[model samples]
Target chain A: MYGESKSGMQCAEFDLLMTDAIDGLLTGDQLSRFEQHKTACPTCSAMFAEAEAGLHWLGQLEEVDPPVNLARNIVLATSGLANEGARASLRSVVNTTPGRPLWDRMRDAFSPRTIWDHVRGTARAIFSPMATPRFAMSAGMAFFSLSMVFTVSGVKISDLRNLDLTPRNLTRTYYATEARAVKYYENIRLVYEIESRVRELRRAASTSSVEPEQENKQKNKQDQKSPKENEQRQYQNFSRQDSASVVIATFDPGESVIGESARQRRKL
Target chain B: MEDAQVVELLVRRCIAGDAAAWEEIVQRFNRRIYNICYRFAGSPTDAEDLTQDVFIKVYRTMASYDGERASFNTWITTVTRNLLVDHFRKTKNDRITDSIDAAPGESEDALPLSDRLEDTGPAPDAHLERRETRELVQAALQKLSPELREAVILRDLQDMDYKEIAQALRVPEGTVKSRINRGRAELARLLQRTYRQVM
Candidate 1:
C-alpha cells in the first residue's frame, strides 16, 4: 500500500500526516497538501482510511473500573508501612536522644554484627517449636478405622511392573472404541433372540389359533420381561447422554472393559 | 486541597501513622495510576500488582520527597514511569501481546484481543462490538515499540500535550512528536487489520 504520489508525498509521509491530521498538528498548508495528495493517490487514501478507522476504534475505549477493594487493600498496606515507619523513627529518636556518645550510637545503628545477631535471634525464635501437637480424643478415635488394621500384602517392584500402570481415565480410550463393536454384536444377538421368540410365539399361536386372546396374553408378558425394560432404560439414557456408561464402566473397575451388560443381556 | 498542600499534609500524617490520610491519598490517584499501569502492562492481570508495587515503592521512599519543586502528580507519575520501565526491562522475556503477534494470515487461530477482555457485562451485540473495537485498539497499541507506545499513550490516552509529554519522558519535543506520530500509524495499521478480521 506504500505507493508514491504525484503531489510529491510518499505513502509513509502520508501515514505520519494521518496522525498529524488527527492530532490537529498539521498546518493549513500541510492539510491542504494532504487533501490534494489523498485525492490524487490511492495508497495514501487507503492508509488515511485505515488510520482513521483505527483511531475511531481506539477512541471508544471505556475507562475500566479498578478491582473491588483495591483502595482498601492499598490503604491497609500503606497503614502497615506507616506504623512500621513510626516505630522505626521512635527507635531512632531513642538511639540519638542524648543518652549515648555519638560514635557509640553510630556503631549501634550501622553495625553489621549487631544486625546479624538480631536476624539470627529472630530466625531462631520463629523456627523454635512453640508446643507439641496434641490431638483431640474425637480426632484420635475417628482416625482408628477398622480398615487400617487389615493390611494388604506389599507389592514388589516386579509385581507392580507386571500390572498396567496407566490411570483408569486413560484406559477409557480403550473402552470407547471397543464398546461400540460390543454393542453392535450384542444388538445382532438381541435381534436374533427376538426373532426366535417370535417364532416360538407363532408356533404357540398356531396351537392356540382357536383363541386370539391367548396370543395377546403371551405378547403382553413378553413386553414386561426385565431384559426388554432394561433395554428401554438404556436407550433412554444413551439418548439423554446420562452417566449410564460411567455406571456400566464402574461395574468392573479393574479395567475399563465395558458393554458386558449388552453381551450378557443383564437387567441393569 | 492544592496538589502541594495535599502532598505535604498526607505525607506528614502518613509518616505519623495516620491511616485515614493514606486512604485518601490512595483513593485520589489510584485510578490514574491504574490506567497508566494497565496501558504499560498491556493486560489487566499485571496492572493491579504493578500499581501496588508502585504505591509500595512510593511509601518506602517517602523520605525523598521535596514538595517545593515538582507537584505530587508529576512526582508520582515519574515514579510510576521509572518503575514501569524497570519492570518492562526486567521482564523482557515475558512478551505482552494479544493474538496479533502470530504468523501472518493466521487470524482464525489467533483469538482477538476482545475475547480476552473481561468485565464486559451483559450488553447487546452492538455493545459487544464496541468493546471488541476497544480491545482491538489496545492490542494494536501493544504492537508498537516501547518508546512509541509510551509516547502514544501519554499523548492520546493520557491527553498530555507535546511539551508535557516531552518533559515527562525526558526527550526533545521533536522526538516525542515523531514517536507519537509513528506510534499512531503502527497502531492504526494493526487496529485496521484486526477490524477487518473481526467484521
Candidate 2:
C-alpha cells in the first residue's frame, strides 16, 4: 500500500509487516495497518503473496519417517555416556534398578586411578629422553626457540664449532661484550679461511710443478681419455681434502659434534 | 503417558543411573533430534554422527538440567542447536570447498520429511512435483546462513511457534521474528530461481 498516509511507514517496514500479516502474527492495529498498506501498494501485496508462498513451501516440508535404526544406533553409541551419568547417581535408587550394570562400578572404581596414572606418565615422559609425541613436540619447540635465540645473539650454531670452550676461553666468552666477540670471531674466521685457501693453492702449484713425473705416473695409472674430466677430478680431490674444519667451539656442550659449514663453503 | 510426563520420568531414571531409562529417553528424542541434525548437516552420515554426539552431550549434561528454566524439549533443542553451531564453525572451511552440485545422497531416508509425509496421500504428477519441490526446498534451505536456516527450520518446517524458537536460540522474540522473515525471503528467492524452469 503506497498511499501517502498521515503516519508514513518505510517500504522495508511495510514489507516486514506484510510477512507478519501472512503468518497471522499481526493483529489489531498492526494487521489493520498492513491490510491498508498492501491494498494501496502492489509491491506490498506481492510481498505478502511471496511470504505466504514461502511459508506454504516450508509447511509442505513434513516430518520425515526417521531412519529405521537411528534410535538403536543412538542408544548403542550413547550407552557409555549414559553410564557415566548413571555412575554418579548409582549410590541412589539406580543401584536397586533391575539389570544394574557392572562396567559402571568398574569404571567408577578404576577410571580416576587410570586417568591419574596417565597424567603422571605424561609428566614423567615429557622431559625424559625416550621420545613421546608430546615430548618430541616440546623438544622441537625448544630447539626452535634456542635456534632463534642463538641467531639473535649473532652466534650461529656453526660458530660454536670454532670457539675454544676450555675453562679459560669459556670465562673470556662469558665476560666479553656480545657485539665485540661476534665481530672478532667474524674477522678471525675470515683470516683463517684466506690462509687455508692460500695453503691449498700453494700445495696445488707445488704438486703441478714439482711432481710433474708423479702426475704423469698417476695419469698413466688412471683413465687419461678426457682432459676436462681429469682437471675436474683434480679440483674435486683438492676440495674434498680441505672442505670441513673442526673449529670445536665449546660454547655449548651439546654442539660438540657440529663442524663449521661456513668454513666448508669457502673450500671451493 | 504424555510426552512431558514420559520425559520427566526418563530424566529422573537417567539421573538415577538407570541405563534402561536412558535408552528410553534416547528412543523418544532420537527421531526428532535426527531430523534436526539432518536439516543442519545435509548428509545422513553427518546427521547420524551429530545426533549420536548430541545425545551423548545431553546425557553428560543431564545433571545440570533444570525443568524450571525450560521444558525438556526446549532445553534439548537448545543443546542440539548449540552443538550444530559449534560443528558448523569447525567445518566451515571444509564446507566452503564443497560444490553446490555435490549434494548428499538422496536416499529415501535422506529425502525431506515433507516428501515422506505426502508420499501416502499424493497421486501421479502431484507426487512428482512435491518430490521435486521438496528436494529443491532442502537444497535451498542448505544455502541459507546458519541463523536464517535454523530460524526457517524451526518456524516453518518444524512448526515451532516464535516463542519456542526464541527460547531455543536464546534470542529475543523480535530477533527471532526478523530472522524468520529474512530466511523465508531467501528461501523463496532460491525456490523461485529453481522453479522458474520446472514450474
Candidate 1, superposed: residue stretches over 4 Å from native: A1-21, A25-54, A84-268, B1-17, B96-98, B101-124, B196-199
Task: Residues A49-143, candidate 1: write the lDDT tens digits.
Answer: 75566556557766677778777777777655554434345344444446579898887666775455446545544543333244355456655
User: Could you tell me the lDDT of residue B16 within candidate 2?
Assistant: 65
Residue-level lDDT of model 2, residues A184-259, one tens digit each, is 9999999999999999999998987877788788888666667778889999886666542443333436554344
- In terms of lDDT, the best-performing candidate is 2
TM-score of candidate 2 relative to the true fold: 0.56
Weakest 10 consecutive residues of candidate 2 chain A by summed lDDT: A89-98
Q: Candidate 1: deviation at residue A102, Å?
A: 22
DockQ of each: 0.20, 0.41
Clashes of each: 0, 10
Instruction: Give candidates' CA RMSD values in order.
Output: 27.8, 24.6
Among these predicted structures, which one has the highest DockQ? 2
